[model samples]
Target: MLVSFRLPLLNEEMDINDAAGIQALLEQLRSSQAWQEAVALPTAPNEPNIVPEPEESNSAPSASVAELLSQLRTEPDTSTLDRPSEPTPSLPKPTTPATPHLTPLTPTAPTADLSDLSRHLTFQQALPVIANLSGNPNLIQTLKSVRVLLTCLLELMFPSQMKDEQHALETRLMEERKAIVTKYEEKVKVAKTKASMIGSGMSKHEASMLSGAFHKELKSFDTERVLTAWDGLVSQQQDALSQLGIPIMFASTEPSHRESQQKVIQVLEGLL
Candidate 1:
């Protein structure tokens, strides 16, 4: 078919030069099955291995001329014959995984430990201590015991020039102490004098008769008992107060364990 068309173009001098005839010939060339079938490409190597049935496949171009003519005479089996064997579709290409935006580890400050202990004074209040000190003029032993405890508390709470203030406070304390002790001492002394009057230069009957009006107040929890208890109690209390004030590091940051320190607060408050 190609040889037949080229023969006319090749013989230029004997060319079919009428424009109408040439246009008709070109239109006929476009509608020709021979031209349409000229590009009968082979099945690709990657084609499916399925051997299609006779119904599914077209007859090869090498088929008999009669069968080819028969196929052309009929309307095409459009469903099977119209579409291309190979189809190309545009698709979005998959992209490379973008660099994982590594978030920089933020360095954090230590959390401020707002504990109950943190808000409290590291030592006892001053007024109650002063009032107790002022009352006991002759409470030499009690003051001595408490003074040692107070000295420790003061030194720990305020590392300032406490020694300077101690001298002045001690001087005044001693005067108050002496005056109180003396008052109690004189009262007891007068009581003794009246008791001594009972044992006058008279007989036993006269002493008994005079003693009828005499009376005495028995002591409550004694000074000795209080002092003994004070030693142990003071030591324990100081130890507790010291423990509460001290800062400690824990082994874990689990949320459940964070409130464990409140246990210490409860126990300390109970003791106080």
Candidate 2:
């Protein structure tokens, strides 16, 4: 800071050459209560306007606050309607978190009789495992990223040997899925029992309120969980479709016939 506090015949004098000078000036300012009080005083009416000097403020849009408000009112916000009232229940602990970088898309867990490993071949069983894996994600991914993951998934699932291996992969995935479900069931049971424990201690009014709240929350929780599961399944199907070009008009087996079919089938089979 450069300052000439003294009102002279012509000009006053003060300038800080470096940080040390600035620090010393600050210390002096802090120590002098009168200086502090003077600094705190409101600016003189005769002083120039202190509007912030935004480098490009003049070049930008200068909509008045009222106009900006009117513009805001013109656009409808759909995000509010799309938000869920409550989140899904916490499921069991997963072994490894899914990644946006999963080189080949695959379900982490199978959806079929995963418990019956013997019912299907190992390769066939892997599809669901890959799908389940694909579903798990950190806080970073969006719906679009999930879609991109499907491309890698398509390539992995639609291999030439898919039919031979699909069932086995499916079986393995089902087994892992059963384990996850069992773990989550146990957690839900614990939460339920804990929830019940709070019931016996309340007055009638409290009981009624708590009961209603829990009922509502539980319903929401269940719906959220079910929807999440359904979404994961649907995502798998969507990924399959994205790879196969819809109806898979490219099959060699018939006019069944013209292109991305085999890859699409491989992708869906892996999800099973």
What C-alpha lDDT do the candidate models reach, one value each?
0.39, 0.40
Q: Which numbered prediction scores highest in lDDT against the true structure?
A: 2
Tell me how far the alpha carbon of residue 44 in candidate 1 is from the true structure, in angstroms, after superposition. 53
Q: Candidate 1: where are CA atoms >4 Å away?
A: 1-223, 244-272
Q: Candidate 2 at residue 72, lDDT? A: 26
Model 1 / residue 41 / CA error / Å = 40
lDDT of 2 by residue, 1-272 (tens): 11223212112223324456445544543455433443444555897544322222231111221222232232333576677668778898877866667487676666564333322324345455445545544211222223222221333333223323444444555575566556555655665676679874335664565557655655664456533543344345443433432333121222222123444344544444
lDDT of 2 at 20: 66
Best-performing candidate as measured by TM-score: 1
Worst 10 residues of 2 by lDDT: 1-10
RMSD of 2: 44.4
Per-residue lDDT tens digits for candidate 1, residues 46-154, read 8764433323455353232224323333344577787777767768799998999999999885576443324332223323333353454433322222322222122
